[model samples]
Target: MRLFYPRGSDHEVTRLVRSDAAAVATLHREDFARPWTTTEFDELLRQNTVFGFAARVIGQPKAPLAGFVLARLAADEAEVLTIAVARAARRLGLGRALMEALLRRLHALRAETLFLEVDETNDPAVHLYRRLGFVEVARRPGYYGGGSEGKSDALVMRLDLGKAPVSR
Candidate 1:
């Protein structure tokens, strides 16, 4: 699936590869308080059940990744491991595109459901998941951090593939 943007965006989504670990790790660090290391990403990429997509700028052979989504599919279910878009690239639709790509792939594999956990304080992410037809199925209090103030709750969101609204 190819989604083209007008003049402002050269971003294109593609299947992620092991070599993308370093760039993905860098992007993860920009958002998450405890980001996964490059080695960890590489190891995840090596797993048979793990797959992902990366959004990168077109027109350049070596454009740095703008965003990425990692996921694991087991049997008939799938779960988002993590997703992040570079701070500079927010609001540009890369995150949605990556997720849509994943949904398409999961549909192809006959996946029954998709699950993801997001920090409740992340309004943008929570809104995006809701827009994509995911609903809050559960919550884990204090799942995000142990900061000075308090840890944030994590919303466990689920999307039933049969009802997923992303165009096939």
Candidate 2:
């Protein structure tokens, strides 16, 4: 997947590797309240069913990653663990591209379903998933955050990879 920005950018997506842990962690920290540690990323990459990829811009120093997606597969079912794009890279097609790439992988693996959880307050994320053919199948009240920040509901969305709409 080319560095999947919505527009005004051209980059490519590369298979996520153990070496990408730091960059992934950095991005996760900036965007997520509970970010995965570098060690965690390393461990996930070691799992046979876990898969991820990093999007990077061309000619950039050290090729800083612009976005990423991670997921796992098991017994015809898969779950999207996370997908994120840098703040500077938002509104680009990176998120969609990541989903498309993951969908391709799931399809190749014979996965029948893909599930993900999104904060109900994340309009962009919810919209993106809906656009990608995911449907709300369940919901968890106060599933995210803790303490003073208050809890947020998580919408459990499902996409039947076998029936996913073709990317345009």
Q: lDDT by residue for model 1 over 51-159, one digit each (tens)?
A: 9999888866377788999999999999999999888888888888889989989999999999999999999999999999999999999998787868999999999
In terms of lDDT, model 2 sits at 0.85
Which segments of model 2 are wrong by more than 4 Å? 1-8, 146-149
lDDT of 2 at 51: 91
lDDT (Cα, 0-100) at 59 in candidate 1: 68
Worst 10 residues of 2 by lDDT: 1-10
* Residue 131 Cα positional deviation in candidate 2, in Å, after optimal superposition: 0.4
Model 2, residue pairs in steric clash? 2-11, 3-11, 3-12, 4-94, 5-93, 6-92, 6-93
Candidate 2 residue lDDT tens string, 5-118: 434568676678888888899999998888899999989989999998777886573767889899999899999998899989888788887788788778878899999999
* Error in Å for residue 77 of model 2: 0.4
Candidate 1 off by > 4 Å: 1-8
TM-scores for every predicted model: 0.93, 0.91
